[model samples]
Target: MTRAKIAKTLLTLPLLSAQLLACQPADGQNPAQPGQPGSLKTLSAPSAAELQSLRSSELPEANTRFALAFFGDLLNETPRENVFISPLSLSIALSMLYQGASGETRQEIADALRYSGLSEAEINAGNLTLRKRLQNSGKGVTVQIANALWGKAGLSFNAGFLSRNQAFYDARLEALDFGSATAVARINQWASDNTNGLIPKVIEEIDPMTILILMNAIYFKGDWSEPFEASQTQERSFYKADGTTLEHPMMQRYDKFRYTNNTDAGFEAVSLPYGEAEETEMILLLPHAGKDLASLRDQLTPENWQSWLSSLRSRDGSVTLPKFKLKTERQLNDTLRRLGMVKAFSEAEAEFDSLLDNSPLKAYVSEVKQDAFIDVNEKGTEAAAVTTITVGATSIQLPQEPFEMVLDRPFLYAIYDRATESLLFMGALNSPEL
Candidate 1:
């Protein structure tokens, strides 16, 4: 028999726009003409002292808060669909872009990312600490991060702006000939290598208006610390969002786990660990039959999430997770606007002066796109996420008392790093692969 693969996830930032995509929902997605190009210069890194000072729990919580906000809006738009996102990766990528934004544009992006109460230094430092803490998390687990900047050959960029991202985010800055096919292949190659080949390509063709491409790819692999018995896996009833039932392979496990039951919120959650140290876990929240994901979306706030997590106590429990695999591609222009990041996408008001040196270059986030993949079974979980920022672009649980939590219907899940309280990946699953 072949050995089972571990869980993996990739977070990518790919920014590109045909014509700046529409910022308004009613207007729909309309591409904008490509803007100017840019090349990087260097400055000093974000303060190391800043990173040291924020070795606290607050930063990870903020990153998670932002992810939940994004999830809520996604649920609002497609209440019955499946969704999985990596907050840590996107936060790092956007925080890099934040260095180049100014005025209302900067503030709007911050608000949309839930970056309030955080100074720019704190944001950069916090992200830097997170990357360090999570990369070498636990034995038997692998978490990889890769960052790169692709710009038009002749474009100009601020020295300090490039330096901060390169230092804090570990991004490789390069001025590529966007007009050449080789540039596309190299960028895609970087994505593929970083994600372990999960996502081979990000952009099919570079839009001429595409001024810059910023990429951040995160790949994570983890095996279940307590592996489920493959023999226990069998076809079981999985309730679908469209009022149908699927006979999917449901892997069953009965053991002691950190669990909590939120009676008031009408949901139960359990944390399944990976690797020997159990530093990373998959926190699964199964909503009550009547409540569904919609109920959880409205209830998911930073305060509430922390409360749910705190409430978890170890106890005997049984979890039945569907063995499934899925891939999703999304253009995030409008959703971002709705989240208070409007000015960055506006052609008239957008401000990215920090990204320019002496050239007559002005750029706005054209489009932000993400492609994600996940697989789960008896062995463990494997997943990858890529959030390409085309400068274009640019949950908890509970349960105990011998709980019986089965993800037979819509539920929420997040791959969390306990060492840093960082959420590498999270999602609402309404449908699973049969």
Candidate 2:
């Protein structure tokens, strides 16, 4: 199958959720409380030797490259809230990238998607078809794929009997003509159950000849060590891109935080870790007065991203930001293939010895979708994200000093692994209302 044909076949799929178990960091890493959702695990906490082995291995490079590319675009596009809670999410997401991909391909993809500010729910819902492909592959790839997909996309995932079933190991593409309505319903039920009803009515129904299904969900809650006093929250006017403004509940706090200022971009950035440094994290960027968010986003790039971080000059200052929550969903299949995952979707080039019993398969991503939800308040952050791939940052340091947190305009943000300097989530938010 050609890449074009394979992509054409990947558009169909499913929904998400699971139990809300508090995550403990593996291997002495920081463990986040139940409320800090993005603080899951990363790459299953590889041992030093194992990490070294993975680093030296020639396999998974393609996947890694793809991951980095995807994440770069995401960081460049996401809101500030999602950026802080990205590491654990990216780790789980990379596990999916590990699925049938290898060499530079896997690494690139892992690097990119791991921190691309995409929500776990959006990632999963959109990639169900790809998930279905691996789930039905009858190979060990299913666990690996599921882990990577969920981890990187900001979903909290745990491997268990359901994923380890022998029946799943023996499954095949018996032909794509089965009535998928029932299958779709069952999948939707699974999603509702997994999410504990956080997400309702996932897929309306599966149309006949459904090619794949991917789904995801996450639940997080956290309180700031020093939350903005309720008394400090007040209605304030917020200017929009248009010459319009709206009153919003703006939260204010004078607590100590990680902050910086960049004279070059005329902006100030603040970082507030969710828990300890090892747990999930969050960061916010505020442009200097008089600059709009769209302008900041337009100036964002990998190099500038690093420069922005490097330019941080922390100094104590008052901080105020709107207390808000937002949710959004989008279809992204075309966007992915357009980014360069041609082979996975082409009927002429699709190969799935990893997914089938050596049967020649014609697969193409039919669609890719994403659903993202987030809330920012004086307490902290709570969010859920889902994205489906199916087929498809630098930093700077500045003088150390206390900094202020003020978000008057749109700004860029990122979530990263403090240890590896790997970015797990990156994006810019021009409008919190979206």
Candidate 3:
């Protein structure tokens, strides 16, 4: 069987935001002309000491709460098809944009993102720590994160907004002629390169009135600490949700793993470590026979997630899992709106005055796009995801006593960073090939 290779990318642009307010151009100032190239300015880099200090700072519980809640909402929205998302990528993009938000706009984003208790500064600092922690690697495992901001060249953006993202998120800054065909090519090329080509194109085209785009890309590759022997793979029957059965290449292994059987939760779980350091793991959760995956998901609150992790125990067991791969793309506009971020998409109410010197040129989020890919096989697991937040006008696992767990049906899974207890990637495997 071929080794797994995964990658993902995302792109976003404002759809519509606050009502346009007429204001006279400043003396000697002119409107941005279409196809005109703009200037590029890089923000001052943070010092080693500064980065270290931020790293030592603790992430607030609000961030964790927001992530779990957001996942629940997304699951509710997309009940079918394989769903895979990188909460870290999405949060980082929104946190960067949060630097420029104010008033009700800021409140809407804060409530939707579960930033209730943390100040803007605290959130930014926490993200710096989160990003660095995720990128830290041990032998045989690679985790990378990249952030960028592309804006119309002639437009004047707030200095603080640019500097804050650069210092905290390490976001790259670029000025592009959005009206130029080459602009889209350049942005998509960046996405492709960052995701190792798993997602070659993130955007079909840039909207004419678009002023800026914020993006985050995360890529992860890891070899299981105990790689499953490929020669042992055999064609086995895998039952689908529809009651049909298909022959799948099932990989098997007998080893000691952190596992749990939650009778109350109605599922079993197992955690498989990656790399020699074992700083990362893939957790698989299989529902009991006759139980629905949705029922288990509904119980996945932050409190329950923590309880499950804490409850996991070491057990010698045998595991049989199908080799699978998945690629998914999602539009999150309605989802975010439904999550209490309505004003941010309203042209009349959105507030982003901090992003531009032209007060009347308020910006609002328009679209949010994400593309993800993942592959799992005998050697290991590799996954990537990209998230883009556009603005134009306003807007697993288990274990048991020498127990045998054969995954012959749909299951839920997660890629987690052990060092920080971060959920890097999550999905439901409804089919082996999707």
Candidate 4:
């Protein structure tokens, strides 16, 4: 059996563009480009005290890194568009979704997506409106999602939980076969419609009672305002962990970049901003020669991450990165606990009753299943990810090498919130799974 692997604690920051890729509707994605007519900001601009004050003891600091599997490409060299999201508005939107969550699980989701930037009055007002929406939301597709999450039976939808198998919350008590082709077709159609054709289909079959499936899809289409010509693409060798290598199409450009070095790990980390100067940055951390990626990752404490950022020096070097398409899916329930979110998985400590209006809620996350699928071609990256929370069970990609950061063996990665120092998501890939 493949050993279970969780991502290292070294998280990556997912700025505005990355978040939009994960959450926004197709037509709503607003890219933030460099030299564009908008003001941009990042976590680096804040004071040390301010950074500290924003820290939360409730969430795991280790949850902040990016997790792209071995042999999997995490496309980091793409240019990103910028957008402004009012912290209050984003929080309200997420809260509304959480209110409909059932069982003893929604609290963790709310806490994870909470905001310190909002005032008490604002939070209260937002909660009221969100509650109303969940209660009054018509019998639309979204209601089906709420039903599945809250364990409402009879709905065609189901939450995969965090497990590797097929499990769902059916509060409506519907007898649904997850392996049915009809089931697969319904989900595929939903994905296609939701992504506005960006993701045509996610589920290909639904008749197998126990089928293991992995998925990740992202859709990003934006004009760079100043697009890179195909003629500018360069050929380069990306070092594989096996000591062999492959020549790949590498994107190259000379622009203002944020570069940093980690003395302990003997590697360099660089940041490439898409649109505005510092609005959203794609970070790449490369380990030095003869150093095990795992060993270097062991030293990735919050302090070290902060120190590494301090060492970053802006430069104008020519950057080269492989343009590759990669996708990854894994079981991550055990991983989240290893990273310090133990209470979330335990029935004794789970506190998600606030999400429902029931007493003595006898429910807990039975599993957590996640799948991430992303592709990078000439057009750009199209990726999608889903996390299933099963009360009785559980469930559930990226590319590119630039400046020769060869991830030969197992390594740590992350995608973070640059402004809040919050680790939005983190993963460790011990072995590359295709």
- Order by lDDT, highest first: 1, 3, 2, 4
Q: Which parts of model 1 have CA positions greater than 4 angstroms off?
A: 1-52, 392-401
Local distance difference test, each candidate: 0.70, 0.39, 0.69, 0.34
| Per-candidate count of clashing residue pairs (backbone under 3 Å) | 41, 112, 28, 75
Worst 10 residues of 2 by lDDT: 2-11
Give a tens-digit lDDT track for model 3, residues 1-434.
21111111111111111111212222323233333111112223345675565545445345556666666676666554467777767777777778788899989988888777667778887676666555666687877777777776676667787779778777656777777989889877877777777777788777777777777777778899999999989998777765678788888998988878798998888888999988788888888777656777698787898889887787888788888887777777787887788887777788887776654665777777787888889999878777767775630444323866788777777887766667777777666773
Model 3 compared with the native: what TM-score? 0.86
Residue 239 displacement in candidate 4 (angstroms): 1.6
TM-scores of the candidates are 0.86, 0.61, 0.86, 0.52
Cα lDDT over the full model 3: 0.69
Worst 10 residues of 1 by lDDT: 1-10
Tens digit per residue, CA lDDT, model 4, 123-156: 3333333222222222211111111111121222
List runs of model 3 lying over 4 Å from the truth: 1-60, 394-400
